[model samples]
Target: MIVLGVNLKKIFNNHFQKYIFLYFLVIVFLMIGISTGAITIRTVDDTAREQIINYLGSFSSIISKDADLNTIKVFRYSITNNIQTIIAIWLLGITVIGVPIVLIIIALRGFIIGFTVAFFIKEFKIKGLTLSLLYLLPQNVFLIFGFIVTSVISILFSISILKNRINVIRRPSFLNRFVNYTITMFIISIIIIIGSLVESFTTPIFLKVINNYLTVFMK
Candidate 1:
């Protein structure tokens, strides 16, 4: 019994370490994409810059006016979009090709975030930085956490599937494991949804406050 306990402890430790390593690996990939995105934003041609700014301005205008009404629309849109991505990651885990796809999705998410922050900072300087931190970071921090956790689990499951195919790991209650995975994913989905709600409902209020501050400061 003591030997069995020791063996289990070792296995748990190994798995924990692997999960940590994978988490950081994913973060590194995300950072690479983020840096690239920031650089791209900084170097884009004037026409492209104008287009991007105009697009962002339109979104801001919508949010600035009738924030309460737009909050519902934003919540619906954000949650739907997030759910689709989560579903894709879950579905893709069943296939061998999903590993790379998951990585790409994570990196793309990071790139979008980096580009947005860069754009704001470039255009508005300190005010942009403040907005990015207040308006963007609050919800995104949770969303990123969800994405990283989901991606790690999805990749691990995919690897498990591959190992099962090759008989590298003994098959024991695969169905049970899968059911647990599904439940876990559902819980993580809820977390992401909460983040969306924060972004949709809470962020606009922050934006309004910031806008008011800027107005007074400029005056």
Candidate 2:
């Protein structure tokens, strides 16, 4: 019994180490994507620049205004988007081809964030940086964290399934694990919803305050 316990402990430790390594590897990929995005922003052509600026401008206009937003609507949208991504990851993990797809999703997330930040910094200079930090970073931080966690869990489960196919371990019951994964995703989605509320309600107020400060300071 003691020996069996020791073996299980060793297996858990090994898996934990692998998870850590995979997490950091994903982080590196994300950072690389971010750097690439920043470089892309710097090297785009005149027409491309115009389009990018216009695209970012639409988002900027939202927070720059002093009007009230439909908070419930924003919350619903945020929750829906988050839950969709989570479900996609969960479903993909059941397939052998999902590993690359999951990685691509992670990279795409990083790229969008990186590009937005770079665009802001390039267009508004220091003020753009301030705006990105204040208006963009808060909600994205939560979303990104949730993405990483869900992706890691998906990849781990996928790998485990592969191992079971090769007879490395007996096939374990999946229902309980799936339920736990679903519950975890629900909790993470809630965190994301809170972030959406902040973005919709608190972020505009923050941007307004910062804009006023910058205006007075410049004067």
Candidate 3:
């Protein structure tokens, strides 16, 4: 356990700079997309808020107005399948094309968060802030850290491998590049799983708070 802790601390210390930069990039992209979306929405209608609420209603309807347990089971399976499909694609690139693939995955993840947050904020006004804080803020904290670490480790492995700094791949060594990537991905996967569980449990509570508080305030 002590050895594991020491290794983890070393890994985190090594990647700290990259992690900070990645977070800043994510925040900047989020702000830009949100500002653009807000400007676009302003040009459409003065009753932009009503339109947003309508859209939210529609979206929520799709989620809640479902069938029984069997339908929910299928829906859950579909979601799992989609996530698995994405992971498989990324893995394919990791093994074939190498480290650039991980960087691409990081960029794509950031873009999705930025776009989604921007969309919600434009549509729901202040409620978007509440909902996002309740939903995304916690999960994103975990995700960004996990992704940045994974990305850094991938890059490090690739660079060392390419430069022949790490001949352990062809020879017997304590830390092979492929083994490092696998371990890094495994750790990141756990963070993602925990984040998902937190989101699943916490979001509904936050949503209820918004429903109750905002419903009274808007009246």
- Top TM-score: which candidate number? 1
Query: Model 3: how far is 62 from its true place, Å?
Result: 3.7
Tens digit per residue, CA lDDT, model 3, 1-219: 999999988977766755676545544544554455445554656576666556545534444464342334543553464346336533643443565455555655666666556656664678777677777788667656655555555555555555554464565442565676766677666775655555555555554554554455456
TM-score winner between 2 and 3, please give it.
2
Task: Report the C-alpha displacement of residue 94, candidate 2, in angstroms.
Answer: 1.7
Residue-wise C-alpha lDDT for candidate 2, range 1-219, written one tens digit per residue: 999999988975885586897888777777877888788797888899777545534544565563654566566776787778888988887776897788888887788888878976876789779878877888877777778767877887778778777884576767776677667666656666666766666554654555564445435
What tens-digit string does per-residue lDDT give for candidate 1 at 10-52? 9757866879988888888889778978988978998998676
Task: Give Cα-based local distance difference scores for all models.
Answer: 0.81, 0.73, 0.57
Find the candidate with the highest lDDT and give its number: 1
- Which sequence of candidate numbers ranks them by TM-score, best first? 1, 2, 3
Q: Model 3 clash pairs?
A: none
Clashing pairs in 2: none
